[model samples]
Target: MSDFNSKHEKVAAKLRNEITGTEYEPGDQLPSEKRLCDYFKVSRVTVRHALQTLENERLIYRKQGLGAFVADTTLNSGLVQLTDFSEDMKKAGLKSSSGLISLDKVEPIKEVNEILQLRPDMKLIRIDRIRFANGNPVAFDITWLPPGYGQLLFDEDLTTQTIYDVLEDKYEIPIQGGSYRITAKNADDYIAKHLGIAPESAVLEIDRCSRTTGNKKVYFQKRYYNPSHVSYVLELSRNDNESMSSKDGLPLKEFSPSFAK
Candidate 1:
């Protein structure tokens, strides 16, 4: 059993190297369990454990009975500074890519005007994208930018990169901070089709309005996340007077008095 553990670790190490080195690029399927077992001279259970470790690391992904595949590298920008989907996925160890769904200059609709704090007659550049992690669609993002930002995107490839990175590196827009709103919603038909989920499935909806130190609105976006594939985590403080809840918000535990207090 000890030997088995070591072999599993070895297999996992090699697989990690392959993934990080891009030996297995995003969207590439990994070898089968049987094949890996043969190569590593390990038992089926050992191979499975190795694969599970990789999955936990978010370096690879498994579909029900479909076999394992290299996880699409993504930037985990949420853990760091504010970033665009394209850039965040890249940092999160998934290959970030995007396809422009649409781009148009339109008068601020009521919702857009409210979100951006714009006048009803304000014209904004709206860009919509279907963002992919390892070539699998995972998010639908719609961004509204004020026109004064000056030719915000140089090319549609901006979808494959982080918007904040682009703005900072290419355009020199520095992000200081912003406000965010997160909620849950049933996936609409469009979201279901793009994310390969059932219609009416629960999904995470994030709306953000970000700005630079200069008080210029850098971007306002609404992102739809596939609930099964991602979850939002909040690190909150719990005073003695507060409470804890299950992920679904059912009450769980009441905070107790502090030891020193």
Candidate 2:
């Protein structure tokens, strides 16, 4: 490798470590290239390469002429990526856990029934969990699945693994695709109790449904997040003919299809 390439690699590794260590908070502006050059005593090429490396890793994002900033924890879930909570946490260098509250077979609720298109007489597997990031509770999740799928899940340990892992690896059911909707919700007594947040607090809620490649519904999930600790992001690409743009300083189509939260 060339000397410049080696320097860039070193610089990138340095920044990557700092970002993972939380030296910079999410959305915080990073030092400018000029400043980075002065600090590292490197050339502009090296600094630019380092910034690009971080951007590519999604640890930082650049705004043209404005410089780069630490990327938010908000998951910018790609439309097609089927990622689970543990995988998402691993990428961010954090340990994840699920506090399994309950796993029972019960009559389907209205929401789960409609989302999963389940027959009224069929029972649903109701699993409740508190998802943690770095050992801190981030989301209170309740998921309902079809009996066949849910039964397969009972053999696995939910506390130590994500359902996605159990389904795909154990049952050989891959979560090929999914859709989600994000909306704000008030924390009720139940949510507050599990999430350890104040009742009536504002929380970000996501309703997600996943299916197999064959179009069979796999799971219907309701997740509530403490907005301060967790966030969501969406990345969009413009076609060759269309210019990229945002609405009112916010990105258009504010949805991350994957359950990155």
Predicted model with the maximum TM-score: 2
Residue 248 in candidate 1, Cα distance off native in Å: 26
Per-residue lDDT of 1-261 in model 1, one digit per residue for the tens?
235446767899999998999587887999999999999887776677677667756688888788999876552211223445654565567777787777778677788776666778888888788877788777888788877652577463666555665665455455556767889999889778877889999888888898864576777888888765566544433333223233324322221111110
Per-residue lDDT tens digits for candidate 2, residues 63-137, read 988999998645542233446778777866778899999999998687688788888778899999999987788
TM-score of predicted model 2? 0.62
Candidate 1 C-alpha error for residue 109, in Å: 1.3
Q: What is the lDDT of residue 71 in candidate 2?
A: 84
**Candidate 1: minimum summed lDDT over ten consecutive residues — where?**
252-261
Position 39, candidate 1: lDDT: 91
Give me the runs in candidate 1 sitting further than 4 Å from their true place. 1-80, 154-156, 236-261
**Candidate 2: which stretches are off by over 4 Å?**
1-80, 242-261
**Each candidate: what lDDT?**
0.69, 0.77
lDDT of 1: 0.69
Worst 10 residues of 2 by lDDT: 248-257
